[model samples]
Target: MDRISDFILPAVIICIVGYGFIKKAPVFDLFLEGAKEGLCTSVQILPALVALMTAVGMIKASGALDSFTYALRPVAALLHLPQEVLPLALLRPISGSGALVIFQDILRQYGPDSLIGRIASVMQGSTETTFYTIAVYYGATKVQKTRHTLPAALTADLVGFLMSALAVRLLLP
Candidate 1:
């Protein structure tokens, strides 16, 4: 398996280059063009990434996140979910890196073998940064007026969070 994994990428590249040669395509030039386009796309998205990172930093520094988490503690308790995972659930849809920091903090606080840790792990796998994705992808494509997308993505994130809790409770020891 290890050998196959090592060989797979080179094999695929070889096949692609071979096919390009057969088709009389300028593989090197095409590769360079693609790389240049990717670099340009990265440059375009840098501002969005910086803005998100700054917002996340400001939110963390302002103690707003803690207040919000405290406010949600009652509802979380009622739902039989860990209060610790609340921030992760809320942030996961807004910023992937921000959610990751929360997720890592959870794992650090409660060892990965703990119930809360397992739930956090599952939640990370199950949920996604819906808003961040929309911002980046739609921003890149210059698509405005994201009507219904926000609601739908957020709904899915909520469901994923609930299912993550249910799954950990039912499946874990």
Candidate 2:
């Protein structure tokens, strides 16, 4: 299985190049064009990315995240969520890397086999970086108004967080 998986990518690449050759396509030129377009898209989204990152940094540095987490503790407790993982749950939607750092801290402090660690791990897997994703993709597409995307995506993230905890509780011994 491992050997087959290893060859899968090379096989796909070879097939693509072969097909291009058989069709007399300018594969290299096409590749270069695609790369250039990708670079342009990256450039277009750079400002959004920068703004999102700056906001995340400011929220963290100003202790807003911690305060928010603290404020949410009662709600988390009401929902039967582990208090320690609240920071991760809050951060997951905003920034994946930031959530990952908190997830890592949870794992190190609680150990992966522990219930809080399991819940955090499940959350990290299930949730999306909602704001970052919206900023990049919408920014690249020059979308000024995100009519329903924000609310829908946030609802999905909320479900993911709730289900992550519920799943860990129900499925794990």
Which candidate number maximizes lDDT? 2
Clash pairs, candidate 2, are none
TM-score of each: 0.81, 0.89
Query: What are the runs in model 2 whose C-alpha is more than 4 Å off?
Result: 1-24
RMSD of each: 3.0, 2.4
Error of 1 at 131 (Å): 2.7
Compare the candidates by TM-score and give the number of the best one: 2
| Candidate 1 vs. true structure, TM-score | 0.81
Instruction: Please give the lDDT score at residue 43 for candidate 1.
Output: 83
Error at 99, model 1, angstroms: 2.3
Off by over 4 Å in 1: 1-24
Q: Backbone clashes per model, in order? A: 0, 0
Give the clashing residue pairs of candidate 1, or none. Answer: none
lDDT of 2 by residue, 30-113 (tens): 989999999999899999999999998888788888998899999999998999999998888887888889999999999999
The worst-scoring run of ten residues by lDDT in candidate 2 lies at 137-146
